[model samples]
Target chain A: MAFINYSAREINCKLVYYGPGLCGKTTNLKCIYERTANDAKGKMISLATETERTLFFDFLPLALGEIRGFKTRFHLYTVPGQVFYDASRKLILKGVDGVVFVADSQEERFEANIESIENLRDNLTEQGFDIAQLPWVIQYNKRDLPNAMPLEELREALNPTGKIPEFEAEASNGKGVFETLKALAKLVLAELKKGGK
Target chain B: MSLTPQLVLLEEDQRQILDVAERLVRDANAKAVYLVDKNGQLVAEAGELKGIDTTSLASLVAGNIAASGGLAKLIGEEEFPTHFHQGERDNVHITLVAQRIILAVIFDDRSSLGLVRLRVKKAGNKLSELFDAIFKRAESELGDNVESPFAEISEEDIDNLFSD
Candidate 1:
């Protein structure tokens, strides 16, 4: 659901980044916050623990250039990827307009990637959104690592649907990061034009 | 139910809100300033403390307004007018304006609670009048398509916002 300010002529949408632990979800946001001109982004808040683990979530509000005259502001957030924080993840998914699944491309973390995707699917279904119909995309992050998984296999395991856009990204270096963001954004606008039934 | 249209504030009134924000910060020597609607759409903000991330915070505040309002409905009560959260690390004061808008300020630990409250009280009334006028304009120009407020701030202009 969206909160419309007919008075302001602006529409605010919430977009959350989801994935398993250490999957570069937060990193993707850090990169964007660093790259976006200060005025284009609002405060980037990372609620992390003493050891730097994301305790709750990473939040950033990005002002994508406007659409149809009105400013399109995306309130981007990232769920704590640890499995035990499943409840927290569910809470953040509330009223989300889109999801960016940041999968760890390393071979050793393959199972974590699978479980995270399953968790996302279950959570979205529980939230009353049909996974197939929602605006979504997948990013194979950490692609520059020496132990990264083969893109072909990663795709087969994570994105069998072949419908949502997929990008190979090294979030640390800002590779394909914007591509993934831009793709999901396009989908969001398309969904809105159809009235987001 | 009262269905009468409220008077609207013009662009100049909005400018007054900005002016108040600057005065509240400079004359008051406060930390950060924020003026949001009753719905929590951030209308304006100014000050230091980078990374405050108003985008998510505004929407979350709006969500808070919604959740609280929903709870009020469930209990068959009128809407809650205003709320405040004074945290150990930071202080937030939210004030109601024109009975339809909210003005909130996020400040540091050093600022005195007495100072923030006093400034907010004075600014709130001015904001209320401005917001009242804006609503009137909104009613009159309901169908006009407006460009994004962000569009007016160019890339260079945006970079300057955080250039220190």
Candidate 2:
């Protein structure tokens, strides 16, 4: 549900970073906040608990370089990752224009990723967004971990549908982070173009 | 009907906001800057952007924040005061100004943490007053009914919005 004011030529889209706990969502945001040029993005806000767990949600607003004379901007959010925070996560997904499913690359976190993906689908349905048609990308994170799960196995369970783009990421060192975001941003803008307004 | 504040209505105030935000941008080295009322109207924006419908987009972003805030309230959490998005290559920061409107900045690889915070702190009060005056006028026009804005929505309009 977007609130569009035609008086100004700016279009704001909401993109949420969603996935299992500790799958590098906040890390991905931190990377973007750090890497974006001083002129293309904005402030990066994080409302995390003192212990570093996301207290509620992580929000970042990106100012994409203008397109076709219109300024394209996106606000990115990340829901709390812990299971008990399901309610909080749903709230963050309310008006999301796109989603990035960050899957923990460790074998132990495989079930978490699957459960999270299911939760994402159910939640999107509740929010009136067609998940199948949504602009979504998958990030297989923690690639640098010594005992990580195989990419094929991770993809089979997380993205077996073969629709969304997927990327490998080592968020700590900033690998594959921008690629995932750029892909999703492109998809989001593309969707808006077809739909107009 | 009361005479609304004349200095801060829509485009007139927007020009002022852009000028002020540009200063904040230069002082802070912020990549992008925008102002939104509490209900999420795009007051002004200055930066390099393409492929965005700013008017609707700013309103929607603010709406996203407000909805998310309501959702947080329902779940019994404190208002999620500030939100930031960290990407691999870029970062966005939003500051709640005077607890009225939002002053947002999108900084890329060049901005330092200290600079962004300092500029936002400096520009916060000015932005707050600018938004408050504008929101007050909007409220007056939509009075006599809290949901009046949507009362005018035709069935076709609703269907079009809900359509895929």
Candidate 3:
């Protein structure tokens, strides 16, 4: 849920980056954290198991400048994408304002991508949020890989609606990372203007 | 089963709870006090917070509470209301408030856990009342269709954020 502190003149929104295991969900956030200026970003916390996979979630607090004299802060979180971590995934979507589905562009991971998308929809539904109505976007990541699927094919399968914005990203090199984030942030703010019902 | 209510912390509400927090710190001699929403947003804080990263702390605290709540359900318990972590020099006491917020107190050798917990219990009740009143007001005012300050924002304004 969005938290607006009138006293502090700040607007806080939550954005989640969700995808299958090893699909660059964490990498996307790391890219943003590395590129953001020091003053604009807070400490990025990753609660993971000893082996370093995200155990619960990764949290990065960002100050996205301000609008109309009120500071805008976006808390970016990424759920552990491994299949067995479904329980943790559901918990992370508690009050998400927006979501970026980071689909692995590799051809072999196609089914895993579809399954994760289905998982996302189900989790959001369980939390009382309709996937179609929520502010959502898709990022076909790992675009630089040799076995990456065609953009059109991926879109036809994942974003059949064609209504939601999509981006092609090679997150390790920071390609299309900011564009995806900027587009999602814009939609989230627009929802806030509509009272975010 | 329902839409999450929008959270609005008004100036008056902030002041009221901040006073309670400040008093809790003074009375308990704690290192810091943080009021965090259950969803991991930092609502307010008081006392010495120099080197601590309250942002990450808030997020981790929420995660802890959520995981603990899950464990409670697995065991057929409703919820676990309080959690305490005793470090060598510092200790943390986290108590759920108003079912939507968490009060986390950090203290050290300067104070005893008994004293901190006592002060926290008294102040937590006061804060819960203040927050309940504020949440009710925010809901009512929202139902009245109050104009949001963001309604007038232009696309250019949002775009400007990424310009740098």
**Tens-digit lDDT track of model 3 for B1-164:** 12667788777778988999999999999999999998899999999978788889999999999889888988999889999999998899999988889999999999998998899899989988988877786667555554577878888887888787
lDDT of 1 by residue, A36-115 (tens): 88878888877789988887778888776554455667778898999988766876776677899999999999999999
Kindly indicate the candidate among 1 and 3 with the higher TM-score. 3
Better by TM-score, candidate 2 or 1:
1
**Model 2: lDDT to the true structure:** 0.72
Fnat per model, in the order given?
Answer: 0.03, 0.01, 0.62
Looking at model 3, residue A21 earns an lDDT score of 94
lDDT by residue (B1-164, candidate 2, tens digit) is 11221112434666767878989888888777887655434666777655555645564566557766776798898577677778787677887875656777888878976778778887877877776765575555423433322234344433332232
> Higher TM-score: candidate 2 or 3?
3
Candidate 1 interface CA RMSD, Å: 10.7
Q: Write the per-residue lDDT of candidate 1 for residues B1-164, one digit (tens) a residue.
A: 01222223334555677898888876445777876543335767777757765765665665555456556666888677567787878777766677655566777766777788888788777777766666675555422554324334344433332243
* Docking quality (DockQ) of candidate 2: 0.05
Worst 10 residues of 2 chain B by lDDT: B1-10
RMSD of 2: 12.2
Off by over 4 Å in 3: B141-147
DockQ of each: 0.08, 0.05, 0.60
The top-ranked prediction according to DockQ is: 3
